[model samples]
Target: MTIHRMLARLAALAALALFAQPAFAAECLLGAPGTTQRVEVSDTGRAMTVHVPGGVDRIRNLPLVFLLHGSGGTGAAMLESSGLAATSDHHGFLLVAPDAGIPVERGFVWNIPGVPTITGEIPTEDDADDVAFLAGTIDWLAERGCIDPDRVYATGLSGGGRMTSWLGCVAADRFAAIAPVVGLRAGNPLPDDPQRPDPATCTPSRAMPVYAFAGADDTVNPVAGGGAGYWQYPMDAALARWAEIDGCREEPETVAVSDTIEERRYARCDGQARVVGRVVAGRGHEWVADNEAMWMFFWRYRH
Candidate 1:
């Protein structure tokens, strides 16, 4: 072969090798099971912890669940305590735990729309839009983590739970289902009556399936209502509003989930959507959701 021809061939080979290396690295980052990494989600410095239990060579079309943390909490803390990571490992799904943009003390809190945060600060235009961040996370995972866009779900705790409900309200089309623990909401409270949910604040584009878990003894977000500006109404009011939105048959049924766990559910709704709430007796304002049950519930829907 001529020296010039050989040099051209070597250049082409080098270019191919150069281009292939990053692709392989990205695949290894995504496909290796039990591997966790901290990723900067977008151009912004907002951090996210992603656990990819999928394949490197072939995309798994795996369901994705965003495990949001409570206020004054970080994504790492949520990943460690929520047990949803292990659940994802068992279920063969991708788990993403992301930090909210607003820094609070040692952690962060979500900038829920039109509601004051746990720090009593109402978000303005300057605050990072958490809803967009999370919704964008769906796109991110689909591109890099072998995620199924139709099977995305979200579950969160405390402030994070309220964020989950807000996502259900605003981004229902993106998520198949939502389970909010300890912080269920239907937007802000009625200006006149703080004990009722404001219907106009949260208008879902379509029917959304909701399963909320709470504790009977939790004074922070009591089922019967009355808390901070963001949590002014009872959990029942939120459920009822969602029931009304889903066009569920009125007069929900109450049953015993167990000797200590009580469930009230609204069924026969539009698109077969159901609104359910479970209260654990002697529990408090903390993470008490059954993770397996949440995955089972999430497994039912696909957008």
Candidate 2:
């Protein structure tokens, strides 16, 4: 072969090797189960801990659940407290707990302020655009082959619960089902008058299933009450309104889950959606142990 031709061939082979090396390296990196990694989810440089379980290469068409922590809590704490990871692992699903992005000395709150009964507003200043961040997180995970776009779900406790309601009202299309524990409606009393940035205005474009839970005796997000510092009215009103929107039948099927938990299911609604209200007996403002029941109920429905 001529020296010039040999040189040209060698150059081409080197270029091919260089190009193939990176692809082969990437494949090697993706060969294992997705590892737990921290990702910056917001522009403020706040990071969220994500557990991919197995690396991206091992995941395909996987369902993901966003677990929100309550007031004065962290994503890690909420995940640990909720015992959701175990459930996710058992069910072959991905679990993600995003930090509230609010820095609290001990933990964090959902950015909701003011007493429930009072005619006061829950300050939303620290209420960063969590909805956008969540959407981005979903997209990011999807790119990693770690999330199933059609099976995304959200659930939270207390303030997190309230946030879930907000998501249902605002980003309804993003979630197949939502489970809010100890949270109230997005905007109570339908917000007297419609406004531009109102959550009630963003009702689901399509029917979305919701499973709500609260301790009947929950003094924090009470079940029935209307007074200064009471927020239960809005919660009750929201559930009823959602029922109407979903066209749920008036009477709910009441059943007992356990001595401490009684369930009221409103099913066969518009779009075949349903809401199961789990009234915890004597429970306080907390994520009751019956979460497994709620999780089971949540897994049954999808978009």
Candidate 3:
């Protein structure tokens, strides 16, 4: 082979390499075990705390869970109230909680679509940009090492739950599964009133696995409509919508998990998706299970 021919072949190979998949790299700094470390989301100055599990050094390919708080709540509050950090410690998964910045007391509120606050005001899109912050958090974590890209999951309470549903709708490509505690049905068309913002446009990238919970006695986001002007629908209706989105077969199997809990499981879904709803009897708007059920549900899925 001539020198010119060899040089041309090398250049061609180099050009082709540019189009190939790049190797994974961890650019962000890692956190310490059993501690919560705050990190900036971006130039936006939005911040979050990542709770590294106690045994992180011994685990590889860890699953990452984004735990969001309700309206007027903060990451610190969620970590304290949800009992998720202990769950993370027990399960060896990473947990992250981001601030929403709608200060009500010591906490904040996530700016979910169409949902207004107690004062009947909705935060504009640019006001929170939670979707971007979440996406950036995931990317930053993935780039930092020990994260299993396929094992990403999200769960939250009230406003945070709505945010989780939004992530399932808009960022489904990145999350393996989601559990929203008392969140609304994403992409369910709203009433034809022009005054209201259109329901969030849901375009899931895959047949997503969803395990949701709702309280029978909840009034904040009631099973029936008309409560503080927040989005309201029966738990069955929300589950049905998710089942349709997940391509599950009709007629879910119902089972009594406990005296206070009944589960409805959708079967034969495309892409191994499982859509489930758990109705908590005689309960109100709350994180009924310390988020253990959500973790178990999330554990079953991986992208």
Candidate 4:
């Protein structure tokens, strides 16, 4: 680990130890572990389904992960498809699958501040603040002693993945890390180029730990780019941009992990952090992320 990263982790651990106690004494708002509870966020008029592991207490200083569904998909659907609850059960963390606020035909799409969605709809400031809603959810859970506020993380599919990327850009301090699947962008594409991210649109408060995933056979949100107005840059460009944002000094390295999965990473980073990703050879535009693999990346960071 870089000395800077080691010191940051140590400092964060000290802060967590000092501040996490009072919240731990409070009763958690959700049902006990081994069960799932659907929660309504009355303020945002959206909902989330939360789950914890079987054996851990509500106050175990656990890691928290948010799973975001694709466009026209619900949080419960994401939970079922990602197979993440099972991984949480085995690893002992809190999991919440949250819905997008804007209602589309069958489901919802995120209200990313200034960009248009795949539906070709641009979000107005009047729309529900999805970013605030997500960050607020973490504060609410921490208040109820339901999760470790410092260990919070997020991951999502398709449109949800774009939302995940947005969070890493604007709410880097609020979330320790983020993983966006099938849909990853540093920011809205530059208007002139349409194939490059506009740097001004995604300046984060910190170097966010980003692990992204895309499938080789996907057509909807192709890894090589060119799909919707919202998706114009290649997946590698997105990863490379994040690697630059994270101050990684080395070129990305790729290794064939297996027939289906190819692992790529930028390991020499400023804070002992890595920008990592996977490309699934045969999979398409679907939830093909390894839940275990994502959780492993998430646990390495803390707010």
Model 2: residues >4 Å from true position, as ranges?
1-37, 42-44, 53-57, 111-127, 189-202, 226-230
**Model 1 Cα lDDT, one tens digit per residue, 172-194:** 99999999999998777888888
Instruction: Give me the overall lDDT of model 1.
Output: 0.86
Residues 1-303 of candidate 3: C-alpha lDDT, one tens digit per residue? 999999999999999998786865755454677888887765667788788898766435689998888877888778788889999998999888888756676777776565575557877665666777788777767776657888999988888888888888888889999988887556534556422223346668888888888888888877554455456455676677778888887689999998989989998898888898887899999986537778888888898
- Please write out the lDDT profile of model 2 over residues 1-303, one tens digit for every residue: 999999999999999988887331111111234445555643456666565554333666678889898867888888878877667656667778888755566775554333221214454655555677788877776665656778898899877887787777767778888888887454443344321123445467777788888877777767764422324354455666677667787677788888877877777797778877777888878886465665676677666
CA lDDT, candidate 1, residue 127? 92
State the TM-score for model 4. 0.89
Error of 4 at 276 (Å): 1.2
lDDT of each: 0.86, 0.68, 0.78, 0.86
Count of steric clashes across candidates, in order: 0, 16, 4, 0
Q: Tell me, by TM-score, which candidate is best.
A: 4
- For candidate 4, lDDT tens digit of each residue in 13-84? 999989877533556757777888898765666679888677775545678999999988889888988999
Model 3 residue 261 distance off true place after TM-score fit, in angstroms: 1.0
- Candidate 3: which pairs clash? 26-143, 72-108, 72-109, 73-108
lDDT of 3 at 211: 86
